[model samples]
Target: MEVTGRRWLLLHADEPGNCPEPSTTPDDYMGGFCAFNFTSGPAAGKFCWDQQPDYSAFRESSFGHGILEVKNETHALWIWHRNQDLYSTAGDMIYIVRQPERCLVESEVP
Candidate 1:
């Protein structure tokens, strides 16, 4: 996601096992995930800024806040906000999930 700045970083990790530490930047962390490339879609295998990240089908630039509702181990809900909206309003939303079986190292059963 092309955020406003470095402070707002949206990263995709295998759950949270490879996420950055609270004290350091995401790219500067000592995580073993080196392949920060698009694995699918039009920009497959390419790095950041080289092309549009097709994995994100829709992206909008809005001035709004966000709410994160962490569900159980497998699911979570992300809700965005805007100042001009109603009390319980959401400018955007995403339902995140962890599917390790789809991210396995080498499973060709598909």
Candidate 2:
């Protein structure tokens, strides 16, 4: 994880993104764990504690695609490719900077 934004003053993560949401089927993480919290952006609410309500942010079984490079208007850069890895190749990348004057008053998030 890497977001150059006041939302997190620039973030970073090595893994544990958490996955296995309400799939409710197709071998959903053996049938359990799901916790995702990122409403808008910049790691919105930031979640993934223990896991149980909902999840979907892990990858490793191969086949992947998730890259966004705004590079402007606030700055952005995210990658997550696994399709054999070739186009630049990126198993995991991040870089999203956006500091809206340090805005984080979502009800003061308890």
Candidate 3:
């Protein structure tokens, strides 16, 4: 995900165990998660601005808010702000889930 000011955050649903220790700037500590990259219309693998225009999708403004609702242990809904509202407005919303079979690494046997 692209954080503001041209900085970028890399995350993959397949291997999220390697996620960094959240962030301190803006004080939003991001926990590990699995999400669907709708920026590319469900293409193969995952989607990020490094290889696609996903960043442009939120080019309007960098300052935004979000709400994470955990429906279960493997599913969540993310709602992002558009920086254009006054009283908790809605912008982007998506249903994210941990697809173990589709987005995970297999254990190696010795």
Per residue, candidate 3 scores C-alpha lDDT tens digits across 37-91 of 3334434434322333464454555687789999986699999987767787777
lDDT of 2 at 99: 62
List runs of model 2 lying over 4 Å from the truth. Answer: 1-58, 63-70, 83-99, 103-110
Ten contiguous residues with the weakest lDDT in model 3: 19-28
On TM-score, who's better, 2 or 3?
3
lDDT of 3: 0.57
lDDT of each: 0.59, 0.55, 0.57
Question: 19-55, model 1: which lDDT tens digit per residue?
Answer: 3443344343443233433466653553333344466
Worst 10 residues of 2 by lDDT: 28-37
Question: In terms of TM-score, which candidate is stronger, 1 or 2?
Answer: 1
Candidate 1's displacement at residue 95, Å, is 0.8
Against the true structure, what is each candidate's TM-score? Answer: 0.46, 0.27, 0.42
CA RMSD per model (angstroms): 11.2, 16.9, 10.6
